[model samples]
Target: MTTDTELKKEIAYNIRAALPKATSYEDYRKLVLALAESGDTTGDKTVSYINYTLLNNRRMKRWDKTLKITDEQMKGIKAFSGKVIWLVLTESWCGDAAHTIPAMNKIAELNPGIDLKILQRDEHPKLMDHFLTNGARSIPKLIMLDANSLEVKGEWGPRPAVAGKMVAHYKKEHGKLTAEFREELQNWYNKDKGQETFNELITLLALENVGNSANL
Candidate 1:
């Protein structure tokens, strides 16, 4: 069970190592939002390819091999009384799903107290529809929820456009998610000028220049 600081440190290292040109928090935030939209809808490959090109380095891929779960470390997260639940709603064939699930697993391994569940969007149409519309239920929905209240703490994706729209819409309609983690991401977005953030936003969606919401 790595401490939140340790986990955040590692995630930050991965973000930096990704060498995303995103310099400010908003720049980075939008970059991720765009990538998610393109990846989910058009099977956009630009951002995904860049991710592979960058983080797929031999050393970085090694991070995957080193990821592990230990009972003791898991127990250390007992202080997370927030009833953390990671809801991964995705498809087996999704490229974005492939990228995200591994990251989710890494996070889960690091935080043992979080309850994680993997659900296929097609199989759980009802759950998928809750956040989607117009027959556009996308894949790779990553939602961190509070089980006791059955409320979402933070959520990301249906992969690309709808996913980004969903978050913004959710914030607009219901108000923003208040989790500290989401705020940290917001901090990353606000720290830089807008360009780096835009590119990184696309990269996070896994489509980059491959395609965009227009195709959907």
Candidate 2:
């Protein structure tokens, strides 16, 4: 039987192997846009997934255009001096990834110490397994690592705190997330304007503070 520590070591090994093949956020965005334009998707290229890819392309564009970070948040982002890589697992058709990844890119943009990388979830099943949320392969999972050491520092994912809570409560009540609830979640993401995601990411960075004393 694999102990937790051994499992983590194995996962880290897998992460190292996957990193070289990971795409930059810019490249991932380009791929997504091309797929949307060509009526295709990254994984399990079903018609519905293709449609979702198309829809998510527009969502990402909107987020890229409209997502705003407050000055304080920017300060928090800039205070971090430790070099790190944010390896994100995602698929083009994931609605949450569409909304949150752009915000992540914006955060990475503000800090030279941070490098953001993307991996297609289906393409890296073994890597995805280690970061599974609730025994399921929930995506847009950000795995933060020490760039030099490749040590896992922390993670943030699938949804923001509030959104995760909402999902949990809804799932508890209904046993599954419905299409209507998904629509509601998208509306929530739109109204929130990526603020929730930004705030949580700022918190994650603070928690991983190496020697930085800056308060968020």
- Give per-model TM-scores: 0.39, 0.95
Give the per-residue lDDT digits (tens) of candidate 2, residues 1-216: 999999988998999899999999899989999999999999998998999999999999888888889999989998887788999999999999999999999999999999999999998999999888999999899999989889888999999989899999999999999999999999999899999999999888888884345533
User: Alpha carbon lDDT of residue 215, candidate 2?
Assistant: 30
Worst ten in a row by lDDT for model 1: 19-28
| RMSD per model, one decimal | 18.9, 2.3
Model 1 residue runs over 4 Å out of place are 1-63, 66-81, 133-135, 159-216
98-157: candidate 1 lDDT, tens digit per residue: 444444555445545455566545545555665553456756666555555434455566
Output the TM-score of candidate 2: 0.95
